[model samples]
Target: MWKSHPKALPYLFLSEMWERFGYYLMIGIFTLYLKDVEAGFAMTEKEASDLYGTFIALVFLTPFIGGLIADRYFGYKKSIVIGGLMMGAGYMLMGIHDKTMLYLAMTLVILGNGFFKPNISTLLGNFYNDDQYKDKKDEGYNIFYMGINVGAFICNFFGAALQILLGWQYAFMAAGIGMFIGVVVFLMGTKHYGDKTEKKGVQEGDMPFYKIVLFILLPSVIFGVIGWLIKGIQSDTNLDSYIFGSDSTDAFIFACIPVIFFYGSLYFKAKSEDKRPIGALLAIFAVVILFWAVFKLNGSALNTWADRYTDREITGTTQTVFNSLKLAKEIEYKKDSTELYDAGFRLQKENGAVKKVVDYPIYFRNVKEDKKPEEGSKISIWATNLSQSINPGWVIILTPLVVAFFTFLRSRKKEPSTPTKIAFGLLISALSVLVMVAAVQIGNNGTEKVSVWWLVANYGVITIGELFLSPMGLSVVSKLSPKNITSLMMGGWFLSTSIGNKMSGVLASLWDTYDNKANFFWVNFALLMFATLLMFALLKQLNKVMKEKGIN
Candidate 1:
């Protein structure tokens, strides 16, 4: 890979791989840690999902500012180093096991990701601007994306082992250690970047940093405050009590108003030659929000599905392997225990105090009577977080094939435009939801556990869609962005992702609301289909802009 590409490619790939390892590891067990009645915060599903959504949304949202700062003031390398250290520190702090510390750690990770994410991507894109590498940009991003999944794919196993062997704190600590290693790897490769890490500096008509803070950042904070304070219509179960679904959701949406306006202004105020590209990029950004909204469910709603609906039991060879690897734990059957759990722990009020009783694990609730172990017998089951690796595993397996398939088309002069790939990607992703709907039906609406293959099959289909859309999205932004605002444009791509991530959270929080789980998945399917239609409708215009820019 390095022979034909920039010497920096391997280093960047490894750095990104490690960074994602830390990130995905933390995320894999985040909600599970939150909802663990014995060792965690004991939050209900809604509370944990709401917080998970907000955490990830903010993580992506910061790139807008981080990218701008890097474009004008801090260079990419400096920003990345600063961000990496913050994230590493944050991950370590999470092991403190205090709510205050957890929030503080989350803040650090969120802000760190903002600075780290877009700048590294922009730095990689910069290398591809040369004529020799220009046509290879998409391929480079795909390889880089594979690196991301490599980290994502392997981290869950380590997480499972650590959490099972030591505790959640140890797993979290491992994430921090991984981040520190990534920073070290990144630093070692600084020499290869040369001048590519330099800042663009402020250009003519560019908003001054102070002015941006005054106009955009300040207003967003105020708008968020208003959204938090002002409640919406009252309803039973607190439905619609706050705008959107929760205070954080409402606040986040409101906060994005000024930022969204800022992006819009970019197109309107652009030089004539730049307007069409910016407009095209923005349109692509908007349509892909639905994709992220669904894809991000891997960490929230899908995690819940793996934990509750999927049959994770192992026996004989499989059980032996998992046990030897420390990836599975033994849960003893205790049929007479008074402890009960539905979505969360069952609580009883006694003398004005609530008590949580320990009983059988929730995993056996849907197991067939015949399949249940005899009393006092133990059954081995793999960690639920291990399911988080399925999508990335597919990405690792299929990326080269997808790249080769597209390359074959390129050889024939018949490869789809980036936008076309993205449109088809949305459609393909929509079909993946149908697999989940089928899973729900097959599992008999959670009355029985479904085969783990349902999750596997679902991830396999979506991974292909992801390959088509995600790397292509990154490549298109690099191809179409005006030279002065490349990082900013990359940030714009993440902005759509941030919004979609929050929306995923909002959707996941409502997991209990659907009596028929298939209906929930159907809603997801509809969102993606609508986005696909919208993208197809605008395809001609988008393609025209790409052609005008002299890019495929």
Candidate 2:
């Protein structure tokens, strides 16, 4: 893959691979660690999911600011190194096992990711923009995305194993170690960055750094405070009446109003030649936020599914293989003891009744009748984190095929415009949610352990959508953005991602609300369908813009 591409491509790819290894490893069990009741923090599902959403949302949000600093002062390499070190330190500190310390650690990771994420992606695109490789830009990003999933695919086993053996803290420390390793690999490729680090000089219509801080950043803080203070007045709950979700979520959405306005103003204020392209990019960003809202459920809602509804039992031949690999987590059962319930299935009861009467753990709902333990008997089961790998595994397997499919279309001169690709992506992703809806019915609303195949199939379908949409979103911004505002536009892309991530958290927090379970999947399906319709409605205009920009 590196044979004909820019020298920087391989280094960037490997660096990202390692970085994702660390990131996904940490995330694979982040909420589980937070709500472990015995060994983990005893946060309610709503609390954990809310915080999870906020953490990941901020993680993507910071890249906007980080991208600006690198564009103006820090430069890509220095920004990446500093960001990586900070992240590594944060992950290590997360092992300290204190709530305040965890918040501090999350703050560091969020800020670190902001500095690191956009710069690395921008740097990779910079390599592809050279005349020798410009045509391969999309292919290059696809290859880079595959690298990201390779890390995501493998990290869960490490998380599961470490958590099983040494507890949550050591698993977190392993995430830190992986991050340091990524930094080491990135530094190993310093020579490759030399040509691509050339900064674009100031261009017309660019806002000054101080002006941006005063107008956008300062306003965002003020808006967030106002939102928080006014939160509960709107809803019956002390918090819900204020916004669609939690107070933090409401505040997050309100704070983004300024940032969103900033991006819109960019289009309004751009030079005439840049206006149409900016408009097209903004439209796509708005619609694709829906796609991300569903896709990001992998970390929240889907993670919950694996933890609760999915049958994780490994037995017979499969159990042997998993055990030999040291990848299986065995859950021991005790007679008359209260069972394990992850945040997803926990419920509260009113009217002075015991909330949880049956001692049966939630996971047993789906165990095969023949395999389930008798009353007052004990049984062991496999690890939960390993379920996180299914989607990334599909990405690793399917990226090449998707790339080849597009390549074949290119040869016929029938390749879809980037916007069209994204539209199809949303449509396909909607179908993946439908698969989960079927899984819900097939499993009889979690009365029995559903086949693991359902999770695998759902992930497989969605990975195709992800491949079509995600990297293309980045490539579109790089191609469409004015040189002076490229990083800022990149921030817009992440801003959409941030919003979607928070929505995913909100949705995940509602896991127990839907008694039918399939209702939850239907909600996801509806969201994606709405996004697809919006994208299709604007397709002609977006295509025209792409044509004018000569991207097809």
Candidate 3:
């Protein structure tokens, strides 16, 4: 894969692979860990998804600060290493099983990711600044993207096996180890990016650090707190008392307002030549919010679909094969065990604060009485986290095919522009949700378990969309961003991702509200189609801007 590409590509690729190995490993099992009841946090689906959304949103949000800091102070290499260590330690600490410790762990990962995520890609983008690599920028991002999914694909297996053979704690510790390895890999290749990762001092047109702190960061904190505390109109439920579904969602959305304003300010503040490109990037960013909202459901809403509604039972020859491969494990259907865990539902949050929710697994509720296993009998079922691997699995399988297809188009001089790819990507992804609607119909709305192939096929279809949108988004930012503000604009891209991720959480938190599961997916379909239409609406103006910028 490194043939004829930048030498830095492999080092960055390997470093990113390990980094994603750690991040995705933890995330793959995060909700399962939260809802474990016996050994973990014992959160309800709503509680877990709310936190999950916030965590990922912040995980992406910090890149704004991280990118800014790297651009002006710490070099990308230093920031990347610092970020990696913090994240590794956080992952290790997650195993301690105390609420305060968990919060501390999460804080470390959040801060670490801020330092790590955007700069590494920015560093890669820097490599392509040279004339020799300029035309290959999108291809490089696609290759880099494949590295991310490779780690994402492999880590789930490790997470699953460790959680099975040892425990969640050990599994988390392995994530730390993966991160450490990533740091080591990056260090070994410092010579490649060390020179390219130059820090840019604050420029005349740029927002100063103090102003950013006052206007964007501090205000975000205050706004978040206000969003958390303010009592507003309610629908006879505390969850709906605040805006945007939950307190965290409210906080996250309100917090983003200032930051969103900051990005919009960049356009108004940009040099004349830079204004159109920034405008184009912001427009695309606005539309992709709907894309990430649906695509990121893999961990929450879709995970639930896999867990409760998907038929995961293994028996006879299939059971023998799964047992041999350790792909599935025997789960003893002990009603007493479920009741015992349910009793401890009011356990401490990560801050040692008490948590309360409706205490029930809801896992057994949908099983047909006659089909239910005899009490205390063990039956083999595929791992819940295994479902998390489906999307990345598709990424690994389909990336080369997508790349080849596009390469063929490039050779024919008929390749869709980056904006065009992204537009189609949104359309294709919208269609993936209909697959779940079909799954819901097939499962009789969770009364029966549907085939695992429904999830697999859905991921397959959407993976093509991912290949189109995600890497292309990175390429667009790298191409369109003004040289001095590249990291900040990259931060803007992640800011959009943060909001969308938070939105995904809000959507997932509503999973129980709809009596018909198909209705939930229909809402997803509608959101994506809306995004698709909006993207097309802006396509002409966006292409004209790209042409003016000489990006293609």
Best-matching candidate per lDDT: 1
* Model 3: ten consecutive residues of lowest lDDT: 337-346
lDDT of each: 0.90, 0.83, 0.86
Off by over 4 Å in 1: 130-139, 270-275, 337-356
Model 2, range 1-552, lDDT digits (tens) per residue? Answer: 788898878888888998898899998888888877766677777888888988998998899888888877888888898899899889998878788999999999999998888888888888877899998987798788888989998888888878877888888898888888988988898887885665553457567889989988999998888777774555444445756567788788889899889889988888999999899889988998888778888877788788777877767887787776767755544332334353334334557553643323556645666777766554445677887899889888888898899989999999998888999999999999989999888888877767778989999999899988987898788788887777678778988999988888888888877888999899999999999999999999988888887876
lDDT of candidate 3 over 1-552, digit per residue (tens): 577788899999999999999999999888888988778987888889999999999998898899889988998888999999999999999988999999899999999999988888888888988999998987898788888989999998888888888899999999999999999999888777658877876866676789879988998898888888876687766646776777888878878878888889989988899989999999999999998999888898888888788778889998897777676778655454223333323233446554543443345555666777998787788778888888888888888888899989999999999999999999999999989999889888888888899999999999889889987898899789988777678878898898899889988999989999899999999999999999999999999988887766
Clashing pairs in 1: none
**TM-score of predicted model 2?**
0.92
Steric clashes per prediction: 0, 6, 1
TM-score of each: 0.94, 0.92, 0.90
- lDDT of candidate 3 vs native? 0.86
